[model samples]
Target chain A: MDLIWDGLRKALELLVGLDPEVLGITLLSLKVSGLATLISVVLGMSAAVAVALNEFPGKRLVIALMNTGMGLPPVVVGLFVTVLLWRNGPLGFLGILYTPAAIILAQAVIATPIIAGLGLAALQHLPPELRLQILSLGATRPQLVWLLLREARLPLLAAVMAGFGGVISEVGASIMVGGNLKGSTRVLTTATVMETSRGNFEVAFALSFLLLILAFSVNALLTHLQQSRRPR
Target chain B: MRAPLLEVLELVVHRDRTPVLDIPSLRVGQGEVLALIGPNGAGKSTLLLTLAALLKPAAGTLAYHGEALDTEARRQAYRRRVTMVFQDPLLFDTTVRENIAAGLRLHGVGAEEREQRVAATAAQFGIGGLLDRSARHLSGGEAQRTALARAFALRPELLLLDEPFSALDPPTRGGLLEDLGRILADTGTSALLATHDQAEASRLANRLAVMKGGRILQEGALQQVMNHPEDPFVAVFVGMETLLQCRVATTTEGLLTLALGGHEIIAVGEAEVGDPILVGIRPEHVTLSLHTDKTSSARNQLAGTVTKVIPWGPFHRVELDCGFDLSTWVTPQSLTELALAPGRPVVAAFKATAVHVVRKGHHGGDAAQT
Candidate 1:
């Protein structure tokens, strides 16, 4: 009980004092997760549209794979990204191992399937006749896709939130691929783990609190957009 | 004659390896309104979609203004001159004004022209007050009105309607039909409408095509097709509820006398003596009265007992057992004035012209003159 009280007081002090190291760690966490979410959204939405609207062999298998990927374990993604970026591994020529770019790639791999699965569901929920109606109005194929995306904007925004939340709060992949280097790759999640391991419970609690606030702020903005209007 | 606005030949559309439409030849002429009437699953919607170029037929040729739309590029270009209004309004999740302006925007109309057309079309459909309202918050009637305004704002050369009013209440459907009739006349836009309502087809179409089982059974002028159905299916489908098998007893001038259930009836037809013919009369063309009047101009009048009275909106369908079962339509006012009820005595009168005569075994062709 004494340790918890000490940790809470330190968390409040770190937040109120505008600690530079804490702020730097929080911003890096946001930047890496934010870029990963953006890349995942672009790739995932395109895959979802193709899968949802077109007919081809193995479509069911592909969808099942996406659903499975939505719940992927982050540790496995971290292992694969680490192997790929190793010096003797297949993609080691660029030498970006233990960098923020490595963390971004790993987080993107963990987030893509989530966005893709949700986006496919959102697009499929629309009435089948809507496509015919739009085409009948002289819309080109690309224009039809644009209009349909607009129609599913609310669910798509939810996908963005889910993707961002998935990567920003994950600690396993960030520690493995980001290496937790001080003043370089140290993020809120890794810093919290390090503080706890070093018996500094107060600083660990402060880092955890900062991570929660970061996730909440991003989610609150996305939820505002998702519920902006009734879609019916 | 002006070239047909649309011509379809040897068209076959399939759904999952089953043919849904197998039309051999059909045409919609310039400035004409053609109604395709059929029962449910009769390929009416499939035909409309095919003509709209939204569905590619498995085997067929579609021509617009004498140009063959055989390629994707050609079909896309032809789509600019055509538009369709589906049964369900299917409005976008936006403001009513934006919904109405969508087609014009796709056609590359400038902002000023698009706004002008959208405002004009909205006012024409009495939806001017709802321009700023979100489409998701509209009533069914308002949504349908916005859809129609959207289709018309494009000012396409051809318009296709797929049961546009089937989902509306009768009064709303009637009012919209009236407005659409006037709009079509004023714009002179050729249109093809598919519906299962016989009355709607008769009121809105200059020509009627009766389809069944993915094939066109008959096509001609509305009155001719209604009065002279080529087959038993068509007779019932076109609302000819009363049919009697009669033997011609005599012929004089342009009229023939037929023996129907030991009674003689006169009809305008071309049947020789002792020839068997089928007589059809629409229920609305038959009038009923409490007493028979000899001075009446109707050629056929028979006394009978009212066997059934089915109430339809503002009207009643009275069935009479006058040696033969005859159905007649009468306004509610007349039904009360004549004291129409089961077992009440009544007289059914009809003109010789109302008796549509057709020879047996002559089906799937133009009406044989009578």
Candidate 2:
């Protein structure tokens, strides 16, 4: 009880005092996750549009694979990414291991399927006649896609939020690929893990509190955007 | 005659190895409104979609302005000249103004021109006040109006309407039909409208085509097709409720005498004596009354009992068993004045010209089936 109360008191003090290291870790977490989410959104939405619009052999198999990927274990992804970026691995020629770029690459891989699965669902929920109607309006193929995306903007935004949420709080992949180098690749989740392992309970608590606030603030803004454009 | 603006030759559309539309040569001339009528699942929509270039026929050649649209580039260019309005008013999730302006934008019209056309079409369709409203918030009629405004804003050369008014209430459908008729005439835009309602087809189309079993059974001027349906199936489908199997007894001048049950009726046709003929008469053309004056120009007057009185809006469909079942429509006022009811004796009168005669051997021996 004393440990928890003391931790809480110190956590509040760190937050109020605006600890530079804690702030830096939080900003790094946001920057890496935000960039990963942006990349995933572009790739995921393209895949979703292709999957949702066209009919081809193995379509069901492809969709099943994406759905399976949505719930993939973070530790497993971390393991695979670590092996790929290792010095002797197949892709180590670029020499980007133990760096922030490695963390972003792994996070994007983790979030892509989640955004794509949700985006496909969002597009499929629209009326089937909408595509024909847009074509009847003389829309070219690209314009048709643009108009459909606009029509499905709400659910697509939800997909973005989900992708962002999936990566920001993830510690396993970030630690494995980023190496948690202080003042370089250290993010809020990895820093929290390190502080706890070092018996710095107060700092760990402060980091956890800061992580929650960060996630809440980003999600709150995205949620605001999603709700404001809702149909009356 | 003016060349046809659109021609469909030997078109066949299949769904999973089963052909749904097999139209052999149909044409729509410039400024012509052709209504295609058929029963449910008769492939009217498939035909319309094929004409709109939205559905590619498995086997056919579509000619636009006498040029074959064989390649994708030709088809795409043809599609830009054509537009369609489906039964459901599929509006995008945007403002009504934007929805109406979308097609113009796609056609690469300048923004100022798009706004002008959208504004004009909105006013024309009586949706001016709804321009700024969200499409999701529109009622069915309003959404449909927005859809029409969108289609018309493009000023397509050939408009294809697939039962655009079928999903509305009767009053709304009637109002929209009247406005659509006026719009088509004002713009001189040729169109092919597919619908199941014969009345709508008759009211809006200069020509009518009756489709059945994936084929165009008959096509001609509206009155010609309605009055002289080539087959018994067409007669019955076109709402000619009274079909009687009669044998020709004799001919005098331009009229032929036919034996109906025990009575002799005169109709305008030329059939050999002792030949079976199918006579069709619309219910509305048969007049019913209580007194048998016989002083009018009607050549056939038969007495019978009213077996059924079906209440139609502002009218009644009274079925009489005058040696043969003769269906006739009478106004409610006439019904009340004549005190018409079931089991009451009444006289049904019709002119010789009202009866449409089809030979028994025409169109695959379908005369006996009716």
Candidate 3:
């Protein structure tokens, strides 16, 4: 109990005073998560709109595949991405293994499915009249795509936030791909794991506290956008 | 007044391999308000959508401005000249001004012109104040008015309305009808509106087309179709509830005695003796009295018991079973004046002019109609 109280006090001190090492880990985590989120959002939204708007053979199978991917374990994603970038794997010439980019790719793989599945659900929730209205209003296919995407901005934002939350808090993918390289690839979750194993409770607690704040802020913003979109 | 601005040729739609709409050649003339009326699931909406060119017909073609409807370019051109206001006022997630400006935006109209047009049309629909307000906040009537203003701003050559007034209040619907009547006349733009309300059709439309089971049962001028509808469905749709098949016997004095259901009653209509006729009258035209009056202008009177009274707004639609089940619409004040109730004997009287003589057997009676 004494040690826990000491760690909490030290964590509060680091937050208030902005300790360099703690701040470094926090910023690096934000960068990796932000990059991963952007990658996931771009790929996810396109896939979601394609599946939601058009019908083709294997459409149901594609949707089922996305549904399965939504629950993919972070460690599994980490292993899969690591192998793709490994020496024996295809396209290993770039040699991006054990780097921040490798970590971003792994986290993005985990986040993509979550963003896509939720995005597809949001698109499905729109009333049929919306499509009919756009068509009847003489909207070209491209114009309609832009219009629908604009209308679904709030949901899409939520999907992005969800993906961000997934990537930022995940430890398994970051540890395997980032290799916990101090000053280079070290992030919040991996740093916390390393500090805790080394009995550095104060550092771990500070990282944990910062991650909590990041997650809370992102979720709150997403919720605010969603509430604003509710029909008056 | 001429061969119509819009003509639909044998437009047919098949849904799940079943024919949902099968409208053979129909036309709407300039400045004419045509009404397509029917009961629920009568393919009224299907026909309207087909006219709007939102759904390609399974077979047949549509023509506007004497040019065949072919190619997306031609269809888009027609769409510029023709527009539809659907049953629900489907507003976008934008301001009322933006919603009204959508059509002009599609044509790449200048921004200043779009604003001016939106303002003018909004004033016309009495929604000028709602311009800056988001469309999601509009009430049903307000949303409908906004949609109308949007469609009107385009000044389309033809307007297809599918139960546009269904969501509006009575006063709003009435005002809209009056405005629509004036606008269509002033612009010389033809309109085809589908509705189930008899009063709506009678007040707004110059011609009425009664549909049933994906086919038009009757189509002609409103009053002519109402008075001498080709089918029982048309008669019922036109508010003719009391239609009795009778054979006119020799007239005694000025009264024409008719045989109905093994009994004889004096019917109010001008018909030749020995002529088999179907006598029909609107419920509102029928008058009920407890006692016969010699001073009444009614040409005929019949005694019947008040069997059922269905209360409508400000009136009661009383059903009388003398020998045939006949309905009479009377004001609530008149119901009290006559002391009418179920199981009470009363005399139903009406003038000969009110009792329209609808010729029967011309189209093989009610069985062959629908």
Candidate 4:
């Protein structure tokens, strides 16, 4: 109990002291996860709207496949992304392996399915007659899509949080694809793993505390947005 | 009518390779409130959607004011000229003001004028106090009022309604119906109201089209369709509750004598002697008398005994056993003055024109006219 207490004391000291190394790792983690979440949102929302609006053959099969993708193992995604970016691989010409870009690419793959599945559900939950009613009001196609998305904005915000939560807390893909290089590719998750493995309990505790704070802050902001506009 | 306001030609709609609607031709004249009435799944809603261009028909040509809506751009432009209200009162998750302003915004109305029109339309619908209230929290009737105000704010050239009052409670439905009837009369806004209630059709429509199995069986003025139903189905659907099967006994110039249960009745219509026909008598057209008057102008007066008295709104339906079963509507005052009761003797009287004759075994391609 004393060791834990001492470790927390030292961690708070490090956080308050504005340690440059800790700050760099935290910012890098945010940058990688934020970019990945943004990419996933764009790709996921487009795919979801396309599937939910139009009816064609194989619709059920496609939805089942997307649901399966939502549970895809991050380690498997890391393995594939590593392979695609490795030297002498098909995409090796870009030479982006063992870098932050590689980690972001892997993280985006991990988040897209989560965002898409939730988005599809959010859009489908609306009343079916709403589309015809809007069109009958003389709305153009783009205006229709905008209005529907606005109606589903609350659920979509939840999708963003879920996507961000999944990617930001993911460590396996970051280590495998990023190589966890010091100062260049290091993030909170990778740094915590490295410090804990080296028996540096105090640093690891600090990093974990920072990670929890970051996740909660981002989610708290989104939750505020999602709930503030609720009907009384 | 010459130079119709809207026309539909050869409209066909299919679902899963099976035809759901196959309207060959129909038209609405200027300033006319045309009602398309039928039972559920009779394609009244589908026809309204098709008229709004929200559903693409398998084959059809739709024209407005003699101008054809042939292309996508033309249809887009045409949509701005009309608005549709659904049965569910589908309002957005916003304030009532925004919900009503949405259509006007889509039509590119300026902000100031949009606000002004929203206010005027809300007041017109008697929802002025609900302008800023959240639509999600409104009662069903208030939500429906918001939906109607939203459509009327556009001041569209044509309005389409799909059972707009069918989902409300009786009192709410009656109030809305009265307000809508008054608004339509004051504005002279051309409209197409789709419903299954004959009372609604009679109250709001200048013309009536009766539909069944995706086809219109008859279409004409309310009185014409109600009195002279060309088809048997139309007779029952139009509230002609009293139908007596009789054989023609004699034919003269523009008149026929029909025999029923050893009784003879005079009717002015076309039919052949010895031909079996069905006589449709509307309950409202049949009057009851305690004593048969020799000076009465009614050609058909039959003595009967009142069997049952069922009280309806403002009137009582008096069932009679006059050799053949018959029913007639009488006001409460008259029911009291005449001392109507079971086993009471009464004379059921109606003019010859009040009875409609439908030739049996003729409801195909063209009714076989004699």
> DockQ for all models, in order?
0.55, 0.61, 0.28, 0.70
Deviation of model 1 at A175, angstroms: 2.3
The numbered model that scores best in lDDT is 1
Worst 10 residues of 2 chain A by lDDT: A223-232
Clashing pairs in 4: none
Q: Per-residue lDDT tens digits of candidate 2, residues A1-232?
A: 8877877788788878888887788889999999999999999999999999898899999999988989877788989999998989989887988899999999999999999999999999989888988888888889999989988988998999999999998999999999999998999999999999999988888788888888899989988987785445
Write one digit per residue (lDDT tens) for candidate 3, span B16-108: 778898888888887888999998899998888777777778898888766778788888667767888888887777889998998788767
Residue B15, candidate 3: how far off, in angstroms? 2.0
Please give the TM-score that candidate 3 achieves against the real structure. Answer: 0.86
- Model 4: per-residue Cα lDDT over B187-270, one tens digit each: 878999999999989989989999988889899998788788877678778888877778889989978898999888888888
Of candidates 2 and 1, the better by TM-score: 2
Instruction: Tell me candidate 2's fraction of native contacts, as a decimal between 0 and 1.
Output: 0.59
- How big an interface RMSD has model 4? 1.2
Among all candidates shown, the one with the greatest TM-score? 2
What would the per-residue lDDT of candidate 1 be over residues B212-323, giving only the tens digit for each residue? 9899989999988988986667887898888777888899998988898888788997877888788788898899987888999999998899999999877888898989
Output the lDDT of residue B287, model 1: 94
lDDT over C-alpha atoms for residue A191 of model 1: 97
State the weakest 10-residue window (summed lDDT) of model 4 chain A.
A2-11
lDDT of each: 0.89, 0.89, 0.82, 0.89
The predicted structure with the larger TM-score, 2 or 3, is 2
- Higher-scoring candidate on TM-score, 1 or 3: 1
* Residue B266, model 3, lDDT: 69
Instruction: Write down the worst ten-residue block by lDDT for model 3 chain B.
Output: B361-370
